[model samples]
Target: MDTGRKQNLKEARTLQIWNVIYDIIEVVVSLIAGFTANSSALIGWGLDSTIEVISAGTLGWRLHGEIKGLDERRVERRKMITLYVIAISFALICVFISYDSISKLISKETASWSTVGIVILIISLAVNPILIYYKRKYGHKLDSPALLADAKDTFICLYQTVVVLIGLLLVKWLGWWWADPVAALLIVPYAAKEGWEAFSKAQRIKNNIDRK
Candidate 1:
């Protein structure tokens, strides 16, 4: 094997492991913060992180794993089907979030301050963009769709941070209670659009090898 190929494989493996750890930790923390503050945007964004976890899992398993023969494509196809199900799960979560945010907006929900969670998100916002640039740089070099997907997920965190920041700012500066959920509502479309693209890509990959 080429040294470059070996390096890419190592990078991919390292990235996948970090991704799994990052998503698991961050999403759990975000959910805790979102609920603690009753912030729709925060919670909605947390759900998005959960979806990314599924995407990363699929990317790692398929992109790095082995398929020895044509017969094994069936197994790979089944695994990809599972990934597609993850995509469906993302859509369902998005719908629920959109509905919840809208309902909260109409009902005049209050978004409180979670000092710790906000601090956590602030750090996440600071760190993610750099990672994305790096991931895209490498993913593009290797033509690794998995890394591309992970890069997108990292960028989504930046977007979610902006949305959450809006809500937080409105609450902090203007005392506008509705602005938080509204900001979250605005980002739902972003989440949906990205997830749809990822789902389509996964479906394409699966369909290419799926005999059934």
Candidate 2:
């Protein structure tokens, strides 16, 4: 590998490591706040964060293999697997969020206002854009589709942060009890779209591998 390629891989791996750490904290804090406030949207977001950890780890592993001079076939195989995993994970997240949101809507559950949830989301709003920018930049630098897909997932999380924050605010201030679940429901279509895109990319990779 050339010097530039090696440097890009190293930087990408470092970014993924930071992503994993941030997501682990997000998972714990969001879940705690979700349960405390009885907010389904917050819970769904927390679950999504869990998948982000897996996505980052998968890409990180792929980058590591490249840095270690793994065989071409093995690296490609790992890339294909990473895409498949990301696709399936997004599908699962869509299903879970859909079910939970609809149930909450039907039951007319009103989540309590959580100061912690608001604080965490505010922090995320500030942080996710930086992550997204670099992830995309390095993803392109390394020419890694899996990394690009992971960046898209991070973008989804940023979108969810905005939507969830709005929902929580409406619930707290305007007595819009249904807003939270509805906000969560809105995430479903986008998640499904990303999932399908990932799956399609994986299929293409599989076909290429088969031809070789």
Best by TM-score: 2
TM-score for each predicted model, relative to the true structure: 0.86, 0.94
Return the TM-score for candidate 2, rounded to 2 decimals.
Answer: 0.94
Model 1, residue 89: distance off in Å is 2.6
Off by over 4 Å in 1: 66-79, 210-212
C-alpha lDDT score of every prediction, in listed order: 0.75, 0.89
Q: Give the distance in Å from residue 132's predicted Cα in candidate 1 to where it truly belongs.
A: 0.5
Most lDDT-accurate candidate: 2
lDDT digits (tens) for residues 1-212 of candidate 2: 89999988999999999999999999899999998999988988888888788888988998999999999888888888987987898899899899888888889999999999998899999989999999889978877777777777889899999999999999999999999999888888887897888788889889989999
Candidate 2 scores a C-alpha RMSD against the true structure in Å of 1.4
